[model samples]
Target: MCGIIGIYGNPEAARMAALGMFAEQHRGQESCGLAVSDGKVIHLYKSMGLVKEVFTDEVLKTLPGYIAVGHVRYPTKGAATKFNTQPHLVETLFGPSYALASNGDLVNYDQIRARLEAENVYFNSDNDGELLVKYLAWQIIAKNKDVVEAIRCLMKDIKGAYSCVFCTRKELYMFRDPLSIRPMIWGKNINGDVVVASESCVLDILDVNGRSEVPAAGIIEVNADGVKVIGNNPAQYRQQNHHSYCVFEHIYFSRPDSYHFGENVFEVREDIGRKLAEQDKGLEADCVVPVPDSANFMAVGYSAASGIPLSLGLIRNHYIGRTFIKPEQTIRDESVRQKFNVLPNFFKGKKVVLVDDSIVRGTTIRKIVRMIKLAGAEEIHLRIGSPAICYSCYYGIDTPHREELAANRYSLEEIKERIGVNSLKYLDMNSLRECLKEPDEYCYACFDGKYPLEKE
Candidate 1:
């Protein structure tokens, strides 16, 4: 998954995009990029680093423009290199023209790339965002299709999750996949300049008070003609009757302050915690401790419901990025060691209920459990917010191989033994659905192995 940002009609568009991308740094950490249009040409700057590291004040000043599109990438489709970094720019004889940045992965990447190559379309990166921009450029340049028409055709043919921000030298466009598997929200700041991002928290930081989701298969364009919102009939593109919004976003990826899919992200997490507490009616624990950051609110609900006092026993290192989002196993393992620590004098002889969002490979949590055990906790009763992630994700997550998943490799009892936890309980599938407003509208493919879309 990645975070995308776009700005229109703002002179300091690049600076605004930088601030917005900073807010979404949690979504991606491997690379960050920006494409700014001064209404004459598009200026591009990207590097393999965090948003703050790459887009310094001096760097933002160099990219002065009224329209900007930015991306924070967590590699899923390609290697974590500067070549795969996005805000992929395409130039023509006229000058540098179109630039696009996107969040989400394409299921038919290989098939579509092969088709484009057959038409003599050259590629520079294996990134899905590059494939998307190239496909649109092909339609617009070769077939003479308008941007809207090309995006419509894209929805019809490209199968997967994509929330994109595309821009010409003079205009900005935003669009989402037919299933709306990812979050994309847009609004205007107090200056009436339009802004779009992967999360509502970005809008909040930009002082955009009134925001709305870019509809499923919907397109939004901003130019001198003014803002236009275009909706698409999902039935025309996807076979699924209801939108298969990614349920995992609420469970883990997005920030607690963000809202999407008609539900507050933190609220959903809290409900998951409450349900988890309900499941453990007679269980006793001295205190409820969250894994910090993502599970902070979940632990709050669990503590309130279970009548166990909440303790900030585990302190996370804000400097360290999320371990789960780290691209490689070695990097993830190293991050787990540096990311968290038990508070001094805490967890000593105490029975702790450890609340975590979900376990993917189980490596991070296992190491965390060992830390608490070493810290002298009498017992660690692990409570997971979501159901077991048995199936690998094909949409945008890095869990592309089933062999890497904990649930796929081990049973619940085996998992408990491996993690060295006193007891283990994952929130059941039915309980998880009860946490969402429109349960049927969300995708639970990772938990249930019922995929909404498949790799072609």
Candidate 2:
């Protein structure tokens, strides 16, 4: 997954995009970039680092423009390198130059790239973002189509999740895949400047008003004329069975404070914990302890439902970036040691109910459980807020291989034994659906292997 933002008609467009990227740093940490259009030229800057490290005040000053697009990349489809960093710029020989940044993965990327390569189109990076821009550029420059027609063609040809933002010399364009698997929202600031982001939290950060989602299978344009829906062809863009919005957004990917799919993430997570408590009705524990950060709200709900007090058994070091987003397994393992620490005397001789978002590889949680046991805790009962992730995600998330996922490789009892936990319970799939406002609208492919798009 990645974070993308576009700012239009703002004097400090680049600066505003920087702030929005900072707010969404949690979504990605491997690299960050921004492209600004001054109505004449598109200036680009990108680097492999955190948002704050990449976009300093001096750097922002260099990107002078009235419209800008930014991206924080997590490397779902390519290696973590400067070449893979986004806000990918494409210079068209016959049409206006444009930059594109997207938040989802394409399952048919290899086929598309091969077709483009056969047409003599060269590639700079292995990333899907570059392929997407090249495809759009091909339609615009080679096929003599406008931006709207190019996007419509993209919607028809691309087969995966993509919530994208594109910026030209004069306009900003945003569109989501037929399923709307990833989140995208648009609003207007007090000055009537249009803002679009992967999440509503950025709109709140910018004090934008009338925050509204870009329609599923929709294309929108923002310019001096204001925000307008260019197209909304749900019938042509719709997936087979349902909308297939990514459920992981509510369970873990999104910020608890953010709202997506007409439901508050924090509330849904809390309800998930309550449901887990209902499942484990006879569980015995001295205190409910969250794994920290993402699981804090779920632990809160578990505490309230189980009539147990909440305690900060694990203290997170917020200075470090999230370990899961780190590209290398070695870095992820090392960061886990530095990212969280056991609170002294908190779990001593106590039975602790450890609440965490979900277990993917199970490496980090295994280490965490070991730390808790070493801290003199009598027992560690692992409670996951989401259902077991038994399958890989094709729509933008980093879970690319089934073998890498612990749940996919082992049974529940085996998982508990492997993690060295006294007991382990994942929220049931039915319970997870019950917590959502529109249960049938989500894609539970990662949990249940029901992919919205056919495997490539």
Candidate 3:
């Protein structure tokens, strides 16, 4: 997964984009990039590091423009190399320049890239965002189509979850797939500058006005004329089945303060915790302790419902990025070690209910459980806020293969034994659906393996 933002009609577009990227730093951390269009030229700057590290004052000053696009890379479809870093820019022979940044993975990227290569479209990197920009450039420059027409054609040809923002010297564009598997929202600032980003949190941070979601299967364009929705054929773009917005965004990915799919992310997680308490009604514990950060709200609900006092048993290092966003397993493991520390005083001689978002590989949680045990917790009850992630996600989340997921490999009892926890429970699907505003509209592919896209 990645974070993408576009700024239009603002003289300090690069600065605003930098702020937006900073607000979304949690979404990605391997690398960050920015591309700014000064009406005469598009200046690009990117490096492997955090957003703050990559966009120092000196770097931002160099990227002067009234239109800008930014990206934070997490390396889902390509290696964590400089070549794969984004805000991918494409220049045509006729002098038109376009830069693109995206937030989701493409299922048919290989097929599309092969076809483009056969037609003599050279490629610089394996990054899906690069392929996407190239495809758009091909349609607009080679096929002689307008931006809207090219995107409409693209919607018909491309298959996967892509919530993207594209910018040119004169205009900005944003779009999401029919399923809306990833989030993208747009709004205008008080200064009449239009902005689009992967989450509403960016809009809030940037103080954008009239913020609203970019319509699913829809294209939004912002130019000198202001914001306009452009699509000649709406019926063709309409989703045939139930919309499959990724439910995991609520469970873990999104910021608590952000709203997506008509629900507050923190509220949904709190509700999940409440339902978890309802399901495991008779369980007894001295206190409810969240794994920290993402699961904090969930544990609050669990504490409120179960009538157990909440305690900060695990203290997170705010300096460390999320372990899950790290590219390699070894790095993730090292990050986990540095990410949290157990509060021995809180756990000593206490029976605690340990609340966490979800367990993917079971490695991190197992280590956490051991730490709590070492702190003198008599009984450690693991309560997960989401269902077991048994399948890999093709829609941008970095879930491991089915066989690598702990749930897919072991039974509940076996898992409990492996994690060295006294007991374990995950939120049931019924409870999960009950907590959401529109359960039918959400995707549970990782938990249930019901992909919205047709399987190859």
| The best candidate in terms of lDDT | 1
Q: How do the residues 145-232 of candidate 2 rate in per-residue lDDT, one tens digit apiece? A: 9888999999888889898999889999998888889999898889898899988899999999798888887889887787788667
Tens digit per residue, CA lDDT, model 1, 1-456: 899999999999999999999999999999999999999989999999999899998998899899999999999999998999998999898743899999999999999999999999999999999999999999999999999999998998899999999999999999999999999999998889999999999999999988999999999999999999998898899887899999999999999999999999999999999999999999989999999899999999999899999999999999999899898999999998899999988999999999999999999999999999999999999999999999989889999999999999999999999999999999999999999999999999999889899878
**lDDT values for all models:** 0.95, 0.90, 0.89
Off by over 4 Å in 3: 231-239
Q: lDDT order of candidates, best first? A: 1, 2, 3
lDDT of 1 at 210: 86
Output the number of the TM-score-best candidate: 1
**What shift in Å separates residue 204 of candidate 3 from its native position after superposition?**
0.9
* TM agreement with the true structure for every prediction: 0.99, 0.98, 0.98
How big is the RMSD of model 3? Answer: 1.2
Show the colliding residue pairs in model 3: none
**Winner of 1 and 3 under lDDT:** 1
